[model samples]
Target: MSIPLALQNEKFANCQESIKILYLVDDNFRCMCDDYNITKENVEFFKQKTEEDFQCRMEYETLSIELEEEILRYIAERTDQ
Candidate 1:
């Protein structure tokens, strides 16, 4: 599936390539449902989804940084041995 330009340029840019497509799909789905202002429940649902996506992105970044650090540490230890 083709990703939306906005998502490709923004939301999915920092994600690992293998997962970028999935994030794009989620983003597009969220955007699609965001245009209607018919009900409180819809707004709440979208809001909750946005918050969840934000949390997931934050966790991914944190884990990526931690993984990089661990890899670097492992390499250093190997070099010193």
Candidate 2:
């Protein structure tokens, strides 16, 4: 199976399988993963900008963190099932 973009983070490395399973079975989780990956890509793109884009980068970074937390929470909830 192809790895989900959100699972590319080292933080989620160990739980990739679990998250992938949830990604396949849950629509909401799949959406969150998609959002997370997009936000992550935005962060990377912003990182290449000049100093004036620092705030934008920070904002994207914060959003990515929130998405990561939500993804983790969803995975935890499903794993406990």
Candidate 3:
């Protein structure tokens, strides 16, 4: 007995869908690995670096505001002189 053409096409379509699903999963895994630094000498290295970078940025913004205030004060003082 021979399989019907419609049944064979349906099977092929199912296989293609399965392949597409696998590709999607593989892509998602690669994206996650890239985001988290999948390979490292130390497991905490990326986390530590991210935290340190955040702290440095916060400190920099605070200092920048302070510097701007000081500059404005200096300009006002010189204008009054």
Q: Top model by TM-score, which number?
A: 2
Q: lDDT of each prediction vs. the true structure?
A: 0.65, 0.82, 0.61
Instruction: Write candidate 3's Cα lDDT for 1-81 as tens digits.
Output: 222233234445756555445445676643543444434324567789899999999999999999999999999999984
Off by over 4 Å in 1: 1-38
Model 3: what TM-score?
0.46
lDDT comparing candidate 1 with the true structure:
0.65
- Sorted by lDDT (best first), the order is 2, 1, 3
* Residue-by-residue lDDT tens digits, candidate 1, 4-75: 344444545576464444445676554553332235456778999999999999999999999999999999
Q: Model 2, which residues run further than 4 Å from truth?
A: 51-81
Predicted structure 2: lDDT: 0.82
The true-versus-predicted C-alpha distance at residue 50 of model 1, in Å, is: 0.5
Error of 1 at 40 (Å): 2.3
Output the worst ten-in-a-row residue range by lDDT, candidate 2.
1-10
Question: Residue 45 in model 3: shift from native, Å?
Answer: 0.7
- Model 3 gets an lDDT of 0.61
| Cα error, candidate 1, residue 33 (Å) | 18
Error of 1 at 63 (Å): 0.7
